[model samples]
Target: MAWVYLIVAGVLEIGWAVGLKLSHGLSLAKPVHTGLTVAAMAASVILLGLAARSLPIGTAYAIWVGIGAAGTAIAGMYLFDEPATVARIAAIGVIVAGVAALKLVS
Candidate 1:
């Protein structure tokens, strides 16, 4: 299903995003991590392209980004002990709500 591909794409988007952070700008630093980051980025984009063939591009892209943003932010708070302020949490909630609305409407 296209939705299944879209969901996989979204999750891999999160992986590549966090990988970018871990890659240290994909410099000479951490070569393995950098390579893996590139790989994840490729996979995410490919899956997204597949999903786009069947789904509305706008809705699909929005959901992809929504999943990436929210997943990364939550992982940052959980793994990196980043700030978990009320405002940031609420912003995440809004993103989630928007994603849900898109899913329901489209």
Candidate 2:
């Protein structure tokens, strides 16, 4: 259950990150996007806290951030037409590997 929360939180982190891009620096003209971004951010933190109740802080934080960073990079490539270079993909792969290693060790 805690793992589930953590995973969902990580996904929400991706959502908020993408939302930040969409929000255009959180301009007032983009109120909807900004609101949604803020909501996602709050929810993600809350879920992270819930997961932290059971998981080690260092392990949970690393995994959460790893998922967010990797997932956001992928999202940028697909949704925003960002570069999908081999180097970028390899970097994401490394982050995923690290996250997996943390999960295994924890």
Model 2 has an lDDT value of 0.97
What ranges in model 2 sit over 4 Å off?
A: none
Best by lDDT: 2
* lDDT, model 2, position 72: 100
What's the TM for model 2?
0.98
Per-residue error (Å), model 2, residue 19? 0.4
- Misplaced by over 4 Å in model 1 are none
Question: Tens-digit lDDT track for model 1 on 1-106?
Answer: 8888888988887887778778878876889989988898898889989999988999999999999999889988986799999999999999999999999998
Write candidate 2's Cα lDDT for 16-75 as tens digits.
999999999777889999999999999999999999999999999999999999999999
Task: Name the weakest run of 10 consecutive residues (lDDT summed) in model 1.
Answer: 19-28
Q: Estimate each model's TM-score.
A: 0.95, 0.98
